[model samples]
Every structure is written in C-alpha cells, then in structure tokens.
Target: MQISRLPRFIRYASALALAVLALFAAMRPAAAAPAHKTEGELSYSSHSGLTNSADGSTGTASTGFQVLLPDGTTRDVNTFGEAIAIAGEHRGSTITLFEPVTLSYTVTVPDGTTINLNSQGGVTYAAISGSSEPPLRVESGSTVAIVNTGATQVARVQNPNGVFAIENKGTLLLGSFVQVLVASGGTAVYGNAPQPAPGAFIVDAPGSSRVSAVQVVQPENQTAAYSGSEGETVVDLLAYVATADSGVTVPVFQLRDKPAEDPTTPSGAPDNEWVLATGPGGATVSDADELVTGDYTFTLRPQGATGDYYGYTVTLTVSVTMPQTVDELRETYRQKLAHALAAYAEADYLADDWANIEAAYQQAFDAINAATEETAMQEAVAGFQTAANLVPTAAERLAAEQQRLLAELDQAYAAYDKADYTAEGWAEITAAYEQGRQGIASATSIADAQAAQQAAVSAMAAVAQKPADPGTKPDTIPATGDPAAIAALMGLGGSAMLAVGVVARKRG
Candidate 1:
C-alpha cells in the first residue's frame, strides 16, 4: 500500500510542476500581442433593411444597429443608443466611455396628451422612484416642441403636466433649459410619414440646459419676454402653416394661460390646440426616437401672411435616449470610410484619407477585442491591416493605425529577430500579416479584397517553399523581406510553423 501511494504522490507532484510551468508560460503576455487591445471599440454594422423589428412602446421604427463589443463573444442589437460593453465577447459587457456616440432623435406628442418618465434618454442606469423623472429634453435651447399628431386629428395637452416659466426659448438658462422650435418632421411618422428610419430623433445638450413644458406666451408686456428676468413664463410655439411645399408663412400663435388673457379673442399670441384640426392646415405627428433629455413645453401656433393669425395647436411628448451605441457609430464610420476611400482612389488620389484610415484600423482592433474566437480575431486583424495599407500614401500610413501596427509588428519581429530572423521569424511575420489581411473583406471592394487574398496565398506558398510539384524545386524563389509580396523569392520560409502554435493554443 505504501509503495503504491508513493507512485501516486510522485505522479501528482509532476502534474503540479507542469501546471506551474504552463501558468508561467501563460503569464508571459501572449508573445507579440499589441500594446493596447481595441477589441471593445470595433464593430460590424449592417443595415439589412431589417429595421429593428423589435417594437417598443415609443412606436418609432427600428434602426438596424448591431454591434460586437470588445471581450464579447456574441453579436447583439444596440438598443436605446446605449454603448455595448467592451470588455468581453459575452452580452452585457461594457467598454466604459470609449464607445463612439452617434444618435439623434426627437419625439413629439400632441398637445393635452401627457408623456411620462418612460421617454427620457440614458435609460441604462438604475431606476429611480420620483414624482418627476424629468425625461423630456430639447437640444440647444430653452423651449420644447409640442407637436400634435393623433388619430382624431389632435393629441390634446393634459393640462399642467409639468409647468415651468421661461424667457424666450433661446436664452437657455442654467438649471431648467426649455426652448420651443418647429421639429423638422412634426409627426415623425415612424410607420407612416418619413425621415428617421425607425428610431426617435436625438438631441445633443452639452450641460445644464433646461426646457420647460406648458409655459404661457406673454403679450408684448414686459413680463411677456424672458423667464429669469421678470418676464412672463411663456410657451414659445412657432407655427408654420404650409402655404406651399417650398414655402410656409409663420401663422398666428394663440396666447394661453395668462390670467387676464381671453380665450375667445386672439391676444396677438400663438394658436393653442383648442379645437381639433379639420382643414388642409392640419398637423401630422410622427414617432421619433431619443430626443433631448430634460423638462420641456411644446406649444403650437399657425402663421400666415397677415402677421401671425390664430392657428391650431399640437403638443409633443419627446423621448431622450443616451450613450448612442455602436450601431450608429458603425453607420458614421461606414459613411466616413466610403467618403474617404472614394477621395483616396482618385487618379490624383494623394490625400491620406486619414479620418477613415484610423477608423478602419480601429474597427479591426475593436473586432478582435470583442470576438472570442481566435479565428475571428486573426481574421479581423488581417482585414484591417490590408485596408490600412490601401490608403495610397505614406503620410496616411504615418497615422496612429500604422504606428500601432508597426509597434506590434516591431515587437513580434523583435521576438523573431531574437530567435534570429530565421524560419520562425518569417513565420511570426506571416501570422501578423495574415491577421491584418483578414480585416479587409468588409472594409474594401471585392476586387481589391480578392487581390489581397490571392496575394496572401502566394505568400503562404513562398513561405512553405514548394516546388512545381511537391517533389521538385519551383522555377523561381520568393524574394526576401517581402513575405507577402510573393513566395517565389528566397525569403525566410515558414507559414505552417507560425499557425501551428496559434491553433494549438486557441483552437484546441
């Protein structure tokens, strides 16, 4: 029994020793890994015309925004303008403030119709109980839009929803910022009218801006002007009656809520949505996504050639969504890349296309950080490097992307050089080049992409040193240093050797 136990102990001790060695190996920082992993910021967005099929109470059409955050192994819908978590390939991971933001939405609820806390932006945080969630916000101003779009021709205002006084809509005070302006599309028809594809309109407010709701439109009286200064707290509702398609004359805005102000006769104020619209001048209310965030007042008034006449009213309920996620970011990136590349491809294409150059490279990096599969990361890297090299000039190549890739290459090459730029050195460079190549498919044209792929294959062939027939030497050998240029030259030979360790370590 003692002898048998002794053998078992020795085996156990040996196993422990192997584990320590493996751990030490693991701790050595992944050989030539890039200094900074941008996996969290990379993404691939496709506008499948799929429109976010998922419905929300907000009623806005969907934006085909999908994202692959860093450290995450899966892909998901980047809803509510929230940034995808960047740390892992798993869902619900976070990348902090690093995610690029691109969201613009506006929601207009009809007058007398009340919208609640469910319409504010940055809905990604912990919930809070309150008498007021203060969700409504108007971007760049003090007044909010009160757009009326209801089946009955009017979404009436629920009186006294959340009242606050304001100067003109533009003063944009410090605490409560409320300003009234005509929304580009009053109704924001998500399912009906046009404009925003599916999501709501988003507003951008730097800080400390406030928009109030249901403020009175003061007469020419001193109190009729500003809110902070002894001015009357009023609703600034600018109304434009579509006199024609290319032109619209500002109409009369009826004054409401002044104690002395009479409802029967117009007091030179704007039109309040007192009665349902039944004529050609009727308003249409559409759904918009995340608008600005804060308190707001929406006033509607019709205008005409004879000064401002009494028009109808419309109240809008707006929603503010924040952290605009990677989908929007991808859209922005795609557009910029296309524009930049188009410019770079000109016969006299001399510009570096730096903006897109960085974005494309970053996209590749982000893909790697977010993807869990080693294959995915390697492919993403390869594609990225390919795109990075296509920008047509060395000036463009001197950018951050180049610096980063070069740095990583330097480290990898250094490792190889340490091993004597031998077969292993060539193998490592080959891997780096392959990783960079994989990132190009989605980033460039098919013709250009195929060219890159062919180039890569030829490179592999050269590295492996094959003959016309596996048994005989080729007519020509690949040149040295240009591992990817071709394999027909006498360059360091090794492709199979490089991919072996990666496959064993990651795929296995």
Candidate 2:
C-alpha cells in the first residue's frame, strides 16, 4: 500500500512541475523579429486613359497615380506624399513619372537618387526642395511648364546653402504670369535665359522667342524713357511684366505715337495710327519698317476678350538713332571674335581632343574672313564657342580612364581560380595583380595605367595547369601467397589509390 502511494505522489509532483514551466513561459516576453530592408525600383504611373472595362470592375475604378514596387507588385497612391514615402523606403531607387501632372504639395527628394521625367512626364505648380549632392535634374526631351494661377507662384526652388541645386538640360517653359524663383547656384545648360543671380531666377526657353527679365532693363521710375540704336531689334523695346498675380495668357500691348494733350492717341496725322501686336511674354513687332524714330506710348494688358484687362498697363518713350555704318558692324564682329578666341584658349581640353578643337577654329576663321554681313560673322563665332564648350578637360579624361581600368581589374580577380593552376603559376598571377594594383594607384597618365592593366591580364591567360599523378607499385611479392590472389590484391590497391587521387583533385 505504501509503494502504491509513492507512485501517486511522484505522478502529482511531475504534473506540478509541468504547470510551473507553462506559467513561466506565459509571463516572459517574446523576442522581436528582424526588420525587412526595402530595396529595388519604385515606379509611379498615372493611368491617364484606362477605364473600368479593361479591369473588369463593377464600379468605376480609381484612375489615379499608382506605384509599382520592385517585387512586381503595385498599389494605388492618392497623394504625392504617399509616393514619396514609398520611394524613400527603397534605397537607391529611381522614381519614373509616366504622365504629366501638377503636384500641389512640396516634394523632398531623397539623397543620392534621381527622378526621371519621361517624354510625356512633367511637374508644375509645386515646390521642390533643393539639394546639391543630388540635383533636381530635368532630363532632355521633357518639357516642364511652370505657369502661375492667380496669386500663387508656379514653382519655387529654395537653396539656402548656395550650392548648385537645379540642373536643367531640357526645356523650361515659363509663362508671363509669374516669376518662378530659383535662387542660389542654379544652372541652366540649354536655355535662352541669363545666368541666375544670388537671389533672382532666370526664366529660360531654349527655342521660344519670349523675352525674359534678363533682356529688359527696367529703371526705378515706371514713366522713364529708354533709348536704343536704329539697327536694334524690336524685341529690345518689349516689356515682360514680372509678377505672380496674373493668369497664363501673354501680355498684349498697342504702340502708337505719344499724344500732345491726352497721351492716349497720336498727336500727328491719321496715318500714325496704333499698331497692334501680341506675344507670350511681350509683343513682337514682326516688321522692322514699322519702327521709326519717334516717341511711342504703349499700353500693356493681359490677353483676353475685348473688355477684360486683368494686368496693369505701361506707357514709355523709346528713341532710336540712325542705322549703324558698315565699318561699325565690322568692328563689332571683330571684337566678338576676339573674345571667343580668348575663351577657347582658356578651356583646358585633353591632348587628344585638341584636333577637333583646331578643326573647329579653322572653320570659324575661314567663315569670318569671307563673311560680308554681321549676322554671318556672328554665327561663325557662336558655332566655334559651342564646339569649345563640348570638349572634356584633361583632368576629367584621366579620371574616367582610371575608373575603367579599376573595373576591369576587379572582374579579372573575381574570375580567377587558384586550384586549377600549379603553385608556381598561381604565384606569378598574384605578382602580376599586385603590380597592376600599384601602377593604377600611382598612375599620373592614362596610357601608362592601361599598359600595366593589360600586362596583368596577359599573365593571367598564361597560367599553367597542374599535371595528374600516376600510381606506382612495389617490385617484389610474397612467395607463399597465391599468384592469382596477389594479382587481384595489387589491382584492388591500384584502383583504390586512383579513386583517392580523383577525390583529392575534385576537392582542390
């Protein structure tokens, strides 16, 4: 009876221990799981024309902007902030815009990344945060149109650090409604606008005939008179209203002779009637014959119907001198050509690139020498300047060559197999690689560095392969053993040795 009671106690004790272990597990906190890294591409596409019929949806599907992740998955994003958040999570990702859209909110691009706007892509009516290391790049062939609507300015690029923040290589269309402020170290490579000042911006269109603020010389008093030469282009008198409180239409103005009393109508005969002209930024006088030596009063208003005047009006006097002489035009061309040649000499191009530069200079020289008109000589000088700007400097060429050599050396080292070659051959390959590495590190010229890299590659190709080992046997055998048995044992031993050799070769 005592023994039976002892077994029951032991069973009760085991149950109590199991209960205690369960309680401890329930009270302890669980370990946290590791976070997943967000990587790869995140693309944004606005389904511009897709309908519900294509998606087989019962109701109207939301045709807003959708983001495609790297894992071949996509989700609809409602705001620009959502898209930016998704893009920021993916390290070193590219944001591709598929359709034209206006973002009302501010876009802060991540560091060391690019936002590519395709042919049909554009962004306007938004503020882009400035960056120096990772610039706000406007790709070629894309048109980024900035237009003001009422009191709101089109776009504002803020760079307080005074670094180059905007890199515009494409077309930037600026309407006459507002001044798109791009302050502090903004670069425009392919536009007609002038270089940006420290606090002011440049409005540039590569092929458009619009006159920007850079071309206009505005005095302190609005009623002041401006003078120009007789041969000056009519665009010189055009005025661009730089304000942010108007619509998208260009300014329209009427030019007429200054009146004596009223100042609205011409003081002379009826033949001196008002000449009407219109343009996107300012009025363009197509015929130069209309511009005579006279004081003109022009009234500027926003382009609209007959009775609507959305913008302000301006009246000014313009005086033109007699047409320039032929000798004066020739002297002007000579001065411009001299300046262009000086600039060409200052551009420190690579040694090999000098041939192209010389050829361009010779062509410019011949064209200017034979040119009879001022326009032809100016064109030749402009062409030469453009050619000179395209050549890379000596330092830039050397850096590129060094990068190429380093990449090739890395590939060679990754593909090398040490076990396939003999010990002596592997040593030779290692020495060659070290020599190439040292040469690249201390190289001052492109040619010497390339030679060193080539030598290492050649040495790697000449590496010798290891020879297979042949098995051997003892000369004497025991006389007491059977001849057949001895022969079988020897054959088995040889087979085993060969198998070991094969295994060793594979392991190597």
Candidate 3:
C-alpha cells in the first residue's frame, strides 16, 4: 500500500511546485523591447535643364546638381521639372548642386526634401513654388538666386494651412522680382526687389524678413577677428529683416578695403570688391591668401537712389587678432580636464551618479582628443566644465546625512528621562548621547554621520532601572502609627479575649 501511494505523493508534490513557479512567472515584469534606430538617407542629383515637365522621364539628362540616393547611387536631373519628379519619388532626400544652373520654369520641391546649393553652386532665374506650406526647406550654405526680369513672380508658396511657407536658412537673392512671397523663417533676404505691389514679398507668420538689420554673425565681437598663424581670417555676416511689401527694396551690403570709399560704387575692381567667402546664408567672408590686420569695415550700400538702408548705413569694424597655436589650445584643454578630474576625485558620489559623471568626462575627453582646431578644443573644455558643475559632491551628501542623524538624536533625547534611571546608568547614557551629538556636529563624511546615528540609538537602548535601597524586605510589617499595623493589633486583641472567655467558660 505504501509503495502504491508513493507515486501519487510524488505527482501531487510536482504539480504544487509547478503551480507556484507559474504564479511567480506571471507576477514578474516583462522585459522591454529594444528601440529601433532610423538612419538618415541622402540622394545626389544635379539641376539639368533637359526636360521641362514632371512627366516621369528617366533619361540621362545631366543637371549641375547631384542627388545622393539611399543606396549610394547618383541620378541625373536636368530640368526643374525632372528635379521635382525625382524629389517626389524619393521623399526626405537631399538634392546637392555641384555647378551653377539657370532654370526658367518654376521649381516646386516636394515635402521632406532638401535642395542644397554648395558655396560654388547657385540657382539663377528660377521661381520656387510649393503645393503646401513649407514645401521647400533651403538648407544652410545654399544660395537661391532669383532674378525676375518680367512681370512673373519669383516665388508663390501657398498651402492649405493658409500660410505661404518656405523655410530659408540660406541666402535669397531677390533681384528685380515683381512679387516674391517668402516665409523666410526669420532669415535675411539680400538684393533689390521692387515691391511693385503691396503683397509682393510678404513675410508671413513667426517673424518678418524685410532686412531690418545687418550684423556680423562671426568674428563674434565685431571689434575682434580671429586670424590663423598663416594669416587667414574668416568673417561671417547676417542680415536681419522684417516682413514688408515687395514695394520695399531689400538692402544690399558690400565689403570694402577702405572705410571712406564710396558705398555706391559697384563691386567690379579687385580693390573695391572684397572676396566674399562662399558658405551658408550668413555670408562667411574669408581671406585665406591675404593677411588681414587692423580694423576693416563693412557698409550697407544704398539700392538705386531712394532705397537706402532707411537713410541709416549699417557699418561694422572687425579687428584681426593672432590665433592661438594648436599646442596652446591643447594645453588649455588639458588644464581644464585636469581640474575637473581633480574635483571628481575629491568628491564621493553614489554609483549611478558617478557613472553619469564618468560618461560626461569621457565624452569631453574624446572631444578634446579628436579636436584639431582651437575653437573645437575650447568648446570641449567649456562643455566639460558645464557637465562637471552638475555633479553632487561628497560634502553635500555628508551634510544631508548629518541633518537626518541630528533629527533622530533630538527625538532620542526627548524620549529619555534622567530621573527614571540610576545616576551611574544615566551618566553613561548622557556620555553616549553627548558623544553622538559631537560626532554628528564634527561629521565630515557619510560614514561619520552613520556612526553618530548608531551611537544615539545605543544610548536610547541603554536605559537602566534605579537600584533598590539597602535592608528593605518586600513582605515586612508596618510601624505602629500605620493604618495596617492598627488593624493587625485590633485583631490580635479580639482573638485573645475570645480565647480567655472560652477558658473561663470551661473552668465554670
């Protein structure tokens, strides 16, 4: 019978164990799925004026612009129509211009697509139109040169959202356009455009782009310019404008060698026309061959006659300063990194906090190591300092622990009574309590605070009772004057009297 029941017992035990395991498994949290990362794709194509319609033609027409495809392939796009067709086919792709091209037809860029015209690349006599607001996004370092001679408008961007949106981070050279509706997104517009009508070049939502001001974006301090050891200097200028009618002519600025020279003179002679460096919308003028020294001025020239910069000529003088050597820049970065590392070593932080600090430090170190220029190295050092400032120090942690320990000690002191315990016992507790308080007051680290807290807890537990007086029995009788003693005497007398009466009665 025992052998037969053994299998049943084993089966029951196995089933019970499995049930418990399943319960625990159901209660456990599920693992999170890994996040998917999307890679950016670029397409290269040139603007070739071969085909003039969006008829889906895949011919080998070569536009100066190159489209870099996701599969690392190049496609030739000749006409603005072909460019638009290719852009529509590959959404979120970039069409890079390698050579200057002139297109007479309107270019309507598709959504999520970028048209990049490099420093050497320019698009002339093309009208940019959009089906939706912000149908085209002009990337930085591109130039959209629109020279409208006839009554045709340069750009007419309209969307169902009731806003004509064209995000232009590059330069918009509006030359003699009858009407150019631009949503510059706060970028500047250069060249003169006669606002022949009231709403010719309307600066829509957000901010206006009607050339409010022209300022230097680089040589950060207008008074100082950074010059390389080889005497190469770079200066960047940006024009700020407000929303205005096309009737308002856009202001134009010119760089000159001499400040007293006439601003109205056309930039044809080498002496008058300073070589404007090719870059993003913000004109980055650089003189690599010539060693620029002292202060050079840039003046906003008047457009025609009546279209001056609102009678106020904007001028900026930029002084050239000697650039720091690579070795000097490295030294500066090393010193900054050393300072941050020293600070990290002196402070104690939790494991998680230390991990964050270490990661930030590593990034800064990598940045400095990879940096070859003075600006990049300086940026690395500055970034490291900013990151290091956010880490919590050991002193802060110790201070918090000390505050907690002090509060616990105060509570312990409140619960203790000197009269309840013997003098020797209470004295011992008092000493321990004082020691704990002193430890807390003098605590310099988290460990010291913890030790102080332990001492306080021990003092709370060391409560001893007062010792009993000598020669005092628990069951001893009371004195004569006491109430208990009087009751005892009266009982004794009554018992004796009763005994005497019984004896007398027996004698009788």
Candidate 4:
C-alpha cells in the first residue's frame, strides 16, 4: 500500500519516457552558427633595410611606401628606388607617379592601372646589357598620360602601352616606339604629327587614335600646281554644325586655315576669294541665321593668264538640320529662353509694353514645359509670337527710349531758359534738369531714362512761385529825443485833440 514501492513496469516506463524526452531535445535544430570568414593581411618583411608599412592607411616608412589594400588589408612597400615595386599588390590597384620614375629594371605595369605622370617629369627605361630594347614594358589596359597643359611640355615614356596617352596637349617624345600603342578600348592622342628622327615607331592595335595637329592641303586652281600633273581642282570643306547638349559648347566654323588665315600670303589665301552660295539643296551660308537643312557649296574662280575666267570649278557641301526631336526641341527652347531673358533683363520692366511682353514670354515658356500634347505646344508657340509683337525688340526699344529722353531733356532746357523765374528758382529747376539729364545719359535702358525724366519734372515743379522783392524797407524811427521832432509831434497831437473837443461840444 505504500507509494515508495512502485510497480516494476511503471518504474521502467517512467525511465523510458525520460530518455525519449532527452533524445527529442537533442534532435531539435540548433541556432544557426555564426558565419566563418578568412582574412588576409599584407605581409611585410624587410630583407635589406628598415621598412615602414601602413596596414589601412597610406604612409611612408624608412623601408618603403605603404598603402591600404582594397580588401581592407594593409600593404607596406619598403623599397622605392626608381619606380616603386607594386606588382605583388592587388591587381587593379592604382599607382600614381607624381615624380619622374626611372625603370632601371624591367617593371611590369599591373593591368587596369591609372598611371598619371607629371608633364615636366618623364619615364625612362635603362637598356639591359644583353637586351636590344629598353627593360620597361607597359602592359595592355594600362592607362598613361602626360599632365602637361601647353604644347611646350613633353612626356617621354619607355613602355608605350603603359601610358594611355602620350600627351594630351603637349609634346610627347617617346623613348621607345611603344608609346603609341593604345589600350584595347583607349585612345592615343599625339599633340602633333609624330616625327621620325631617332627611328620610325610602330603603333599597336589601339581602339582609336587622334592627332591634334594636321596639315590641310590648300585649295588650288589645279592639283598639279607646284607639280607637273593635271587633275581635278577639288577642295573639301570641314563639316560644321552648332548644336550642343547638356550645356556643352561646340566650336564655330572658320572658313580659313588653322594657324594662318591670310590666304593671299605664302602661308595662306584671302578668305574673300571664295564665295559661299546656296546650293541645289537650298541651304545658305549664314552664321547668324539658322540655315535651312540642305547642301551648301563654296565656289571660287581664279583669273587666268589670259584675263579670262579659269575653267576650273570648286564646290563644298554643308548639311543643316533643325531641331525635330524632343531633346532637340528642349535644347532649342532653352537657348531661346536665355536670349529672351537677357533681353527682358535689359528692358524697362516698369513700362506696360515691356512688362506685358515679358510676362507673356514667361507664361508661354512655362506652358511649353508643362504641355503634354502637340496642340498645347502649338498654342504656347502662338502665344509667344503674339507677345513678341506686343513690344519692339530690346535693342530697338532701348534706342528709341534714349532718343526720346534726349529730346525731352532738350525741351526742358528750352523751358527753363524761357521761364521768368528768380535766379534761386532757376537754380533749383536747373539742378533737377541736370540730374535728369545725367540719369538719361547714363541710363542703360528705357526704364532708367523714364525714371530720370520723372525726377527732372519733379524738380521743375518743386520750385515755389517766383518770389517778389519788397522795396527797400522803411528805416526805423530814431529815438524821439530831438526837441524839434518832439515839438512837431506835440503840435500835431494838440491840433487833433482841439478838433475832437470842438466837435463834441457842438454835438452836446
């Protein structure tokens, strides 16, 4: 009957149940284990001299230069005699050469390195005793260029492909011909024609290349001039167009040579000798006017020895296209808006005519930007046209206003001269008129002149009525101390008193 003695089956069952619970708890999935990562450090050991290395920053140590690797690791370079040895560093790490770098030994430019060289500095390679070529070689995809600004500066490169460009605007004298080798997708620009004095250089496969300076053959009566051959007298015109996007500015066309424009001289010819005319394409050679989209030709006829027109004919075609696409329209609209705003800024905004025109233009431009349909755009265009007609152009209005102000100033002068006013009044009026005249003279626009005119008018009216001079003021009576004057006054008083007494007595 005592509970202390449990049945054998019950005790065994309890034990088994406890064991099953423990097994289930162990089978449950454990919390996700933290991800494990491997980290690498830039190992540095100086074999020859003391080397200072930075792990995550750029610094200079007695041994070498240390740079932070892209992988959050630090690399310390201890030896930097000529060009620092960085071939063992990251693949795409950039090494900037701030000073002249000498490659006494073979130095391979890591792939995708951007090597910026000083214009005044240069890169030279030492010729190995046994090798016929310089020890330096630039790897493909390595970009190199000179930082020189003027054409006078020069950049010399030992390995061509190592530098992307020889010189952007300056001269580039290659130590070896490899300098002209452009990268796979890079361009090599030579400041001028590559001359061969040391040796002829070969250019490897570059995506593209450009020469800043090239000699253009002048147009002649015949190709045989200076030579002894008869051929067609033909000339090619450099194509020109004036349209820009994203606020970019394009150079204008010049109908002359690059350096020398005087064609009559030995180096050039007179620009007027050639005439530009509308070709069959109906295009005109106008710089200010938007040319019609078509072909334009330039024709020139030289006088022959016989005093007759030469049989040769020369022509050039120019194609013009107006804005038609949305982008083009937007750019054109911005240009027009700038022009209109400049004019409006110079106009007399206080005047109803100018203000109205300006407001209309602003509204039209706003509508143009807000319009989503062609009809709305057309409406805005029409509105702008109407507003333009409401007032004269900015220049015309300013000129006319100045003329009117001048006339008004002259009239004011005449009125001041004719008016019969005192000197003081005249001074006030003249002062006002002079101030107004000065304003008008210095006025940049019509509003300024109008304001000046008002000032003059106000001055003229500010003069009060002409003052009249009272005749010399009577002298004050002297002290009544003179006996003669006192007697006279007493006699007059007695006479007046006697007459008054007689009249009073008679009336009584």
Better of 1 and 2 by lDDT: 2
Tens-digit per-residue lDDT, 213-259, candidate 3 = 11111211223243334534342222111112112223333222121
Scanning candidate 4 in windows of ten residues, the lowest lDDT window is 223-232
Model 2 residue 336 distance off true place after TM-score fit, in angstroms? 2.0
For residues 258-351, could you state the per-residue lDDT of candidate 2 as single tens digits? 1122222223322111133432235444634334444444444334333322223433333333454666766667678677767755346765
Which regions in candidate 2 have their CA more than 4 angstroms from the true location? 1-322, 345-347, 403-415, 422-431, 434-438, 458-467, 472-508
Output the number of the TM-score-best candidate: 2
Q: Write the per-residue lDDT of candidate 1 for residues 297-352, one digit (tens) a residue.
A: 33334443443332234443212122324554444444544444454433332344
Evaluation by lDDT, superior candidate among 3 and 4: 3
Task: Show model 1 residue runs off by greater than 4 Å.
Answer: 1-271, 274-309, 312-336, 349-508
Every candidate's lDDT: 0.33, 0.49, 0.49, 0.44
lDDT of 4 at 65: 35
By lDDT: ranked, best first: 3, 2, 4, 1
Error in Å for residue 141 of model 2: 60
Report the lDDT of model 1 for residue 175. Answer: 12
Sort order, TM-score high to low: 2, 3, 4, 1
RMSD of each: 32.9, 26.7, 25.3, 25.4
